[model samples]
Target: MLKEVYGNECSSRTQVYKWFKLFKEERETTEEDPHPGPPSTSKKEENIEEISKLIREDRRLSIRGLAEKTGIDKECVRQILHESFNMRKVCAEMMPKLLTPEQKESRMKICVDIPNNIDIS
Candidate 1:
């Protein structure tokens, strides 16, 4: 009946059946149960600080190297560098989050200068 009414908008029959069973059992909410395990600690403040310090010390440190030094997974280190720090690797080195206006002007000048400075002879 729900499938008929909702058509393709409805969830799978199995999921609908599960919800129906829960409703029959007087379940008030459809929220999921809390996971039964230790929570992740990799994204903690201390870890972020440590990762930041490590990266500051050596901007060229590879993700694998950071992971090995900090005893954290490579993926976690990468997340901290990218998401938390808003950094990206360029030329195998981590660059600042945003370039200064002067730096942008310098880069533009260099780009324009390249064509004029070139001697095709």
Candidate 2:
């Protein structure tokens, strides 16, 4: 309507008023997207549950086995065990059985059996 009013005179009041109005309208019309922010900071729960399931199903599984099962790297599995689950390797007890009195004496005689012929006596 303002362009229709301005007939190439270059002094039209309507053109100045409409330009300012359009500029203000454009400023109000444009808006930044509301969803802008950092990416997700949490891991998927499914991955955590899968890791837990794999560990529970085989407590003694090697890191490679766990990695195969969970689709993660072997190093990653070890990290999850150490950091997330607080797991450690359990050592087997290897102490010998209690010795009988006769067995003890026999062992002691064996220790003295060395070099009886070379004794000072």
> Against the true structure, whose TM-score is highest?
1
Residue 11, model 2: lDDT of 36
Q: Tens digits of per-residue lDDT for model 1 on 1-121?
A: 8568646755666666666776678765434733222245577789899989998898899889989998777898888899988998888888767999998999899999999999999
Clashing pairs in 1: none
Model 2 misplacement above 4 A: 1-44, 91-121
Clash number for model 1?
Answer: 0
Runs in model 1 deviating more than 4 A are 1-38, 105-121
Q: What does the lDDT come to for candidate 2?
A: 0.57
Worst 10 residues of 1 by lDDT: 30-39
Shift in Å, residue 88, candidate 2:
1.8
Best by lDDT: 1
Compared with the true structure, all predictions reach lDDT values of: 0.79, 0.57
What TM-score goes with each of the models?
A: 0.56, 0.37
